[model samples]
Target: MLKTILHYINVNRWRLIKISKNNFLIYCSVFVGLMGGLAAVALKYLVHFMEDLSRNIGAHVPFHFMYIFLPALGILLTILYQHLVNRDQIQKGIGTIIFNIKRNKANMKFNNVYSHLITSSLTVGFGGSSGLEAPIVSTGAAIGSVTGRFFKLTTHQKSLLIAAGASAGIAAVFNSPIAGVLFSLEILLGEISIPTFIPLLIASATGVVVAKILYSRQLFHLATEGWHLQALPFYLLLGLLSGWTAIYISNVAHKLEKGIFKKQNRYVRAVLGGLILGVIILIFPPLLGEGYHYLQEVLNGNINVLQEESLFSTWLQHPLIMAGFIAALVFMKVIAAGITLGSGGNGGTFAPTMFTGAFLGLFVAYAVNLTGWVHLNTSNFIAVGMAGALSGVLHAPLTAIFLIAEITGGYILFIPLMIVSAISYIIARLSNSHNMYWHDLIHEKNVRPDKDYEMLTAIEIRKVVNRKYTAVKRNRPIKELYKLMAETSTNIFAVLDDEKHLQGVVLLDELRKRIVDGTLSATATIEDLMIEPPAVIEYNQSAEDVMDLFDTLDVWQLPVVYHGRFVGFVSKSNMLTEYRKVLIGQHHQPDPFGH
Candidate 1:
């Protein structure tokens, strides 16, 4: 029966492939959108369920007091799950997804489909200072990837599916379909082809519809008073502040991961991180979990709601004190999110970015209003600030703008949103070349796109190394070299010692010149015909480096060496062929989904 089922599947798969690419993708998009939406809803339910359970356990304990040990336990459980059950490292959230697209040809790990849901639920549900959007994005991308594999989809189709999944997941979470589509195009795929856009639009719209059906509440329903032109300068200033804050978030998270948590034992690091986070939570309960509730409080001009819940309620009532507290949140949020995720919490920076943006906007508005120089609507500033921080941190201005507009019920603060996002994006670009996600892939792995280098990055030297070239002993007779040339295809040969250590190379063209001159005797040795190669190519050398060497040396071919042994010869021609292949993979191929 199992064999028959397998046979049936194979036959159906063939039929599916026979469908036109565009129609098949349209069909897959609907499935991916529906599934991605369901995954988002399920993740939200699990998180809320865990949160309710944790709350029940802490019913008698003060909210701050309960977090002292809750976040610690959650981190420990997350770490143990990875170590004992999953037995794999937690990934770098959406960065890994983009890396897979660029370097791994969109082939995603199957484990990501469910692992993020498990670990992130545990982390955020139990009060870890993190977000759910990243995990759900990972889950959605994995869904697209596995589905592509199941149908044996083309590489382009697989990539589109992955993008669609990501967009859908984000759309479901925020109930903002346009933002979802923009996020996939701006951040994930980095290209805007019409063929890709249709599927993304369908998936994102479907995801949002599902989210609405299951959980009808919009993420943020801000009554944003229209922005005043007088506040334009202040908005610009807020943009700069948000840009700097974004830099702090990106750098602090990256530094903590590399410097603090990198050397410590995983278990020990997780404990220390959790304990520290708990202390912060005890001091600033708003930083706990997703912090969305606190964000609403701030935007609603009820910043004192958090003060009422704090141990220092009396001290927090002072206007200056309240302002300082809110400002401190903007800076400390970076540390809170960094430590939580750096120490093994399975959550993303998405929620934290929004959290930081909302509070930062509130702080800026409150501070400016206190000065009596400008009258700014606190809610308007909060919405604009969200866009500003998002633009800077995620390097996505359009997404930040549209997401804030849609969630806020309309584009009432459109001008301020555009101003803040544009300025913030520019400032972020000046601070760092790549956004929070792409920077790791570029600086850590050297996988960023460069017209000359991207093709080289995708291919390895072994793929183009000419193993067909033969090696001759340095002592072999020149007359024997003539006999060897007759037997072989072309001119390049490595002259090596008995142990195969490359001594030098013999060019058949040069040897043939000598042969034509009639200056070689039967006893003339290959050593006499050999000369030091201008440059030797290492088998592991990057394609860019190899190409650079070729141009620098003006050589048509270079002998390839690997760990003190002669491997083969690599020619300029082979490099060009590989580069063209890469170019085709990246750009030149006919659209897999044509109209």
Candidate 2:
């Protein structure tokens, strides 16, 4: 009765259905969507709490004195969680989500998700210099998997759920549904097919609606000025610089973190990060928090930028002071963000990437302004360059550009956004680390985003099933069947006729039963004992489709056929083992950290 109800739910709820045999896959996707929605809200609240706390404590307390304290606090909390939770996995956060969706896989462990949330919050909140995108993505993927599992979705449906969950998470956090949809297709699923696009759009839009009602958050408040269309050349220059900065940022963080991996103790490594950040913060409090306030000042044209003072200069040179100070701070900000990540902090590179792009834009604008060739607003350049640079480095040109547009609703910057984002993305690809944060993570884990048994769990039955037939006429002797079962060492055999139609299957235990009843010597046909109308597969089904077959059938083995001929059999062992492989080294093996 429960199965019938679930089948009804699946059939009605989901538009895309893979199985012609049953409506079970449909049910699973509905389950994934419902659960994913709820989980997204919870995770957002958790992230918000950490961000709020980070602001309050850093501002009120003397961060200089407490900078060392914050690092110790983060380390102690982490060690304590490691002790209490007894988790054997490294918390890669969003990188883990990207890892799962790269194939028809889902390892959405709730405890692991919780671990990521806590650790990543600590990483960013107290001056770790990372972004918040990591936790959001992890939580989103977890929501999807949990939902799919509750409904017992097929592998392909689960894959779609993973993308949906990721999209929903992005929408909830950023409050941008379209960006979420594009990200789901481009980054998560790697496909934007009509079938996949519809669900992604629905899920992302739903998440955005929820987020908008709750947060009402503003993306960027800057009003774009009249962009010089002829300044296209300058925009390309900004793109080149932004791409270099992004590559530099990625390289520094990855290299430093990798270098530290050769060292032994976790605490000591963390302490080193603390010491570096503390020294930097002693001079610059703006570097201590999320750094948004400082960025806000730049966007508002209110920075106390340092200008250069000549030796012969008289009184205070205000302009020179601002230039020197601003340039120096940008460089220090990079160091702080880099050191924070190198020490195994949990946050993401997303926010930091935007921050770095803003700084890069400031530098270019300052230099451009110095030349007196063209006028550029500090705020507009940073805003537009940030979108372009982020788009380029992340390789989601449309999403980044749209996110920038949506943030400020800037009509003038549209063409520049397009031109700059593409240029930056192209320039960043010149060196290695072409892919964004998680794409690079996939390589470190050595798991191909592509499909294979050792790689992809969803194995097609037609590929591995035995094509030979052991069935005979009902009058065939039981002794002959017994010999066949022993010789083949197969647990089941499909009975078929000369026309190649499925008859029935005989188990090894059945042959033993006939022998014990003294009917072994008699000629009996295989059809009399075989199970008729065995499960079949169309040739076009994916590995994910095959996995759904295993889930619905609940049998150890099933004969696969196309056009009424026995082709092969798929076993439960291959399916389960293949799926579980995703979670294997994900716990034990220590890979290089996220980009």
| Candidate with best TM-score | 1
Return the top candidate by lDDT.
1
Give each model's whole-structure lDDT: 0.85, 0.63
List where candidate 2 sits over 4 angstroms from the true fold. 1-63, 86-90, 259-262, 305-321, 328-334, 436-442, 449-595
Error of model 1, residue 64, in angstroms = 3.8
Predicted candidate 2, C-alpha RMSD: 12.9
Cα lDDT tens digits, model 1, 1-595, are 9998788577556655587667888888989999899999999899999899888888878766797878978888899998898888546478888888777767887888888888999899999999999999998998898887776676678889999999999999999999999999998888888999999999999998898899886677787657677888889899999889888888887776553467789898888889999999888889889999888877777877878668788998888988999988888877888888888888888888898998899998899888888788998888888899899989999999999998877587888899899999999999998897888888788878544665688778899998887888877677777677679887888888877789999888888788789887768888988999998888889888899989998998998888989888999999999888877765433433342
Weakest lDDT window of 10 consecutive positions for candidate 2: 586-595
